[model samples]
Target: MHGRQLCVCVCAAWFLAANGEDVTCLSEYYMGREGFRSVPLSPLVYTPIAHRPDWYWKKIFQMRGIDPESVKSGYTEAWLAFLFVEAQEAMTVCSIEGGRYWDCILDVRKVYDLAQGSARSTFAGRLAAVFGITLAAPDPLPGHLRLSLCAPARCTESQVVQEIFPLAVDMLMGERPQQMLGNASFRDVVVAHEVAGWHDFDIDFAIVGVNRCGTTSLRKNMELHPDVVIKGDEEETILSYELANRLLPLKAQVEEYNAQVQERITAKFKATGHRPHIVGIGNPLLFQSALVRQKLALMPQLKLVLAVCEPVGRMEKIFMMEKYCHDDLPAAQKRLVAWPYRDGSEVCFPSTSALLTERHGQLKLFWDQRIATAQHLAALAELFPSRLFVLHQTELRDTPSNIFNELAAFVGLRPFPEKIVFRRYNSVGGHRTDLCFNASLVRSLQRLLEREYVMQESILQAFRGIRIAARSTRCDLVDKVDTTYCPNMAC
Candidate 1:
């Protein structure tokens, strides 16, 4: 009786534990892990397609010897049909049993190698990095017999497929073809080609980040110099995350998007009356996202200028200024936010944390997968070398003269103009934050920020170093425009 009672207790405990957790797998943890491995999450989600059926892929072993049913379930119609035809052709060239396997392996390796350096590398690397495991094909099975599906585990087969789906596809696709992968720019394709061969790059520079950094300030200042043509913004992100989701092994969507963006910028300069010598795109958010690094690897000629601010202060600025999150909140709930910067107006809070994890319709899941500051910054720096230029709020206010001069030179521009204009907005520090959150809630946030940034000396140091470097290198001639009121709704 005691034995049965103890067993019951054990079963109950297991049930309770299972019931206590969330359903979806942890994504942010994977993201942080990917950063450490110098890979981003996008690429791992897709892989190249191959020529033959069960030719060289390890996943073929997991499924019984390639049956029609197995092939049908493994890939989409276009990709699978193409593979089937290719397999038939490859078999004719070298029987599946003979030298064909070695040929297949060699071919797949080339494609994999090429993608390893481009955005795809970071994408696939991200998964490998997060799981803290390397992706290696299982050794080929013995000649006659095939691995069978016996009693299966409780997990669904789909879960298992998602895991090895990428590698399986790559084995089917042979070498990296000449055609551009989907819409990937020529610049990015060139980078991938170079990386595949493991060669040095002559890339001019990189913008490196997406949006909201001092990149705007840097770009504006650089624009004044006769030598520079500041490139406008484009959806470079579509190339990284969206295109990575497809089944076409030859198509790299993210690269295509960036290529188009770059071309447009280049064309804009070519069409103009007086084309500038130095050309660049200032999309600050790109630095925060993995896509920028991938794009940078391709356009080696493009120099990089990254403007960084204190993470805690930046987050605060984002939250108080209302960058992107305002769209999600209801107008009634929005009105609750009182902006001290403007009279009787509402401000936006940038963090989506409240929506993703909050008790209301939004803000709940937002905090659930909030990316860490150190992780975000490190990911960008890892992708691009010394091209990044950092700027800080404190540094700008403290040593404006020296910092401005250094910044100008870093971007290969002229000296700073002694007098400059700055657009002034109401100081947030003095604003009454009472309507923002209750004291207890504010305390909780403070603790969160302190835990996230204050303890991270490395990130702080990187920020400081970038700022000092920019100041020491460039010349600043930005005239602070009039008090440019941040649109209340936009903030």
Candidate 2:
């Protein structure tokens, strides 16, 4: 699978095993430049986390004290070197080639008989970029090129090698390869993870849905639930993509996700000593991908909370968002990724102001966009009715206390404190509190609300069990008129 399979031959090595057959790395099939031979396997395992660990190594420092944090974080090369000086094994395996250490990040023979696939094609190029050395193309089986990298201040060698090891193993083993070499970060968390019976993420819930809704506030409330661990920002852009990649197989994606998060959540567990049962990402844009409508399908067991408001209000809030709020947006749209729009085709503007100004003409695009999102929501509800929850943004704004407590129970977590304060993380009705919709927009907005809004009891058709917030989706128009905020102008 790694390289070309030449003319078929009856080789005993190719005989079927329970899992799969062993790969035969042939020299003629494998491509290489000039003559490259075997390089002995270097003993260097995980790269030191800190780059300048050599600086700290000294017998003089032994008389003084070593920093425990530095050692724990893999920056104690000085202490380690002092210990290993007599053995000379470490010195034999590694060397100060130039000014910096070119630690052996890859030895092709250990994982495979030959340099193949990504290791064959791009490994040399990547090593050159990172360590600044152009290498001849490596050969097969007998050996090719070995890639060693000199890291900057931080060592990403463990991450880079770990990605390669698993993918390349499948070619040799025929089925799959279990990573023999452990990531230093992964090693730190394995014991704690097993003890806690936790997977990558400990918590059981996620807040996935409409922007400008109370998704932020809901997550914050959950964090206050006595024993909970919520990592990173309100939007988990990294973790969300892994969960929603339509192209990648679930197992492969999960293993990669595990490799990443195996360190993240469990590290928090180690620090806090409280094994939080409530740990999950809260990203509002999870279901926005048209290609992967079933984003929640990635974690089917996960209890999903989607907070949605009346369509007009949500859009209006974004339109009225303070300029200061859009401060982080770039001056010009460099790429489609600048905005987390559904896909590459969607119009991307630099700022919220630009989006509102340019795309205001496509106001009725609201129904198409939201209705499609609602369909995605409906599909998830059908699949995991007991697990999927639709939270009414109107209700959350109305009765924050009750909504929070009930939501905690939904996720099988304890409620927030009885006297705890509930604050809105995102609420922007700055420009005009009154509705400014014309008659046509008003009618369209209501239909959008009734079809999708949990408050109207319309979405309840799919999700029967949820905390309902009784709030009036009605406000007087700014044009000296009274028209309802919700669909069908009812309440």
Best candidate according to lDDT: 2
**lDDT values of the candidates?**
0.38, 0.44
Residue 406's lDDT in candidate 1: 74
lDDT value for candidate 2? 0.44
Candidate 1 residue lDDT tens string, 105-129: 1122233334433534443444344
lDDT of 2 by residue, 197-313 (tens): 013233367777766677777776667665566656447664445433221222344455445455655766697665665666777776554323333443545787877766565
- In angstroms, the error of model 1 at 284 is 3.0
Q: For candidate 1, give the lDDT of residue 310.
A: 41
Query: Candidate 1, which segments miss by more than 4 Å at Cα?
Result: 1-57, 60-204, 210-215, 233-274, 298-303, 310-362, 394-404, 416-443, 451-457, 460-484, 487-491
Maximum-TM-score candidate: 2
